[model samples]
Target: MEDPAQRRVDYGDRSFDEADLAACPLEQFQRWYSAAVDSGEPEPNAMTLATAGPDGPSARTVLLKGVDARGFVLYTNQRSRKARAIAHEPRVALLLVWHGTHRQVAVRGRAEVLPRAETEAYFASRPYGSRIGAWASEQSEPIASAAGLHEREAQLRRRFPDTGSPGDVPAPPHWGGYLVRAVEVEFWQGRTSRLHDRLVLLSRDGSPAALDDGAAWRLERRQP
Candidate 1:
């Protein structure tokens, strides 16, 4: 086997300074997000979500569904491990890595359950197959076999009969979304010699302040 330690990547000369940041963290995030998309980064909105509970911390990758002045949003099963963890401890962290762009964004925040209306609207926007799968599989649950899961999906497909209509399948009661109200957002840019650029935006009062409130946040650079 090749030596893993021998693998090296000299991340180019990109630099991120305070002046490069937007008025607020969310704005800065949008700029970076757009750059990642324009760079042809596949699944640029995918992010690692971390939550802690009595058992400990757990993390998984989830696709970002939306973002606004409130923060980032993602959907999942309400009964999943991550959701249970959020119930125990609302505080969570998110990391979005854009390998193609040699950049990353980290967020520390509180996860709040999205309103049913929002969840329903987003769910309705999902592909017909995805809608069926959402109801068929119990996320994070053990199953005897993939066949069994497919069988369950088959049953839902029979019930919903996908006619390419968004209203055909309604959102499952347990399937919903969460909005991460960020207290701190950090942007990182890769540079040579393992010395990266890290600029962090923090809520002045250490709370989840409005993302657009320029006075509510302060930016700081960290040693990299």
Candidate 2:
């Protein structure tokens, strides 16, 4: 029994200057997000979602479904452990990593369920199998066996035979979306000698209004 390999890799000298920051944090996020995508980063939209309940903290990775003037969007089952935790405590955190580009973003925010119409539109756009999965798997729920899970999938398939036209697959009653309106956001860029660049933006009232208006957020640099 021993520690893992100890190898240190020196980072690049990239910098994130306050002068070049976008008027709104969402705009800045779009720029960095596009960079990650153009660099061919694997699953560039994947994000780590952290939630807390009365018991303790929980974390899981979920794909970034969308982003707009308001905030970051992701879809999940309403009965999920994360959703339950969010109901108990609406505060949550999100982390996005672009290791190949030596960049990362951490966001502390409050999660809110999206409007039903918005969720329906997003759900209708998903692949047919994924739409079926929304109905088949009671996310975060224990099952007796693998066969049992497959059985549920089989039932869903029979209910919706056309896999090409996902629109025909009704959105599950318990599946929808959440918008994380950032209260605070930090962007980190790796630099040489372990010194990194950290820039943070804070919303005045920790609400979407403060997040999107540009003038309501205070921006500052943090020591690495």
Candidate 3:
């Protein structure tokens, strides 16, 4: 097997400076996120979520459904491996890569399970087919075959004949959202000769306002 890293591709394109970044890390993240979407990147909300478990760390790509001052929010089946990992270790890390734009955001923080009401609201708002699929599939669980999945889907379809009605779809107890309260946020911008710009913001007591007046977060530049 070839080591992909050995195949070097020079990243001598763009440069970033501390003076050009947003005062708050979240703002900078938004700027990059918007660019990612505008650039036609597939699934711009997709991010690699890393969680620690007994064996080691596990990572999976999950869609970022929400983000705000509270942090980044993603949903998953409660019985999934990632959810179990979160139960054991509340801390989590998220890596968002926009290769088209040569930008990345690394976030580390604590994850909290959102309340049932919030989960239900989000669940009800999903597309009808997605809601049905959520009910039909036992995520991260072993299945007999592809036919089994189709059979399960058939059964769900019969149970909930009307797809458009929210009444036909109930939020699965195993499905919910987890909010990552970021304590550390790093923004990386690729530059020429690998002299990339790396700016980090560290939160004080999980508060975004702490970065205000230079008291909330300490900003630093790292050598690329």
Model 2 clash pairs are none
The lDDT of model 2 is 0.88
Q: Across residues 58-152, which tens digit of lDDT does each residue of candidate 2 receive?
A: 99999999888778899999999999999999999999999888899999988999999999998988888888888999899899999999998
In model 1, which runs have C-alpha deviations exceeding 4 angstroms?
none
Better model by TM-score, 1 or 3? 1
Listed in order, each prediction's TM-score against the native is 0.98, 0.94, 0.91
The digit string of per-residue lDDT tens for model 1 on 166-219 reads 899999999999999999998999999989999888999998988888889988
RMSD of each: 0.9, 1.7, 2.3
Ranking by lDDT: 1, 2, 3
lDDT of 1 at 178: 99
Tens-digit lDDT track of model 3 for 94-124 = 9999988888999988899998998999898
Clashes of each: 0, 0, 3
| Residue-level error in angstroms, candidate 3, position 178 | 0.3
The list of candidate 2 runs beyond 4 A from truth reads 1-5, 206-210
Q: Give the C-alpha miss distance for residue 159 in model 2, angstroms.
A: 1.3
Worst 10 residues of 2 by lDDT: 204-213
Q: Give the top-scoring candidate (TM-score).
A: 1
For model 3 the local lDDT of residue 154 reads: 89
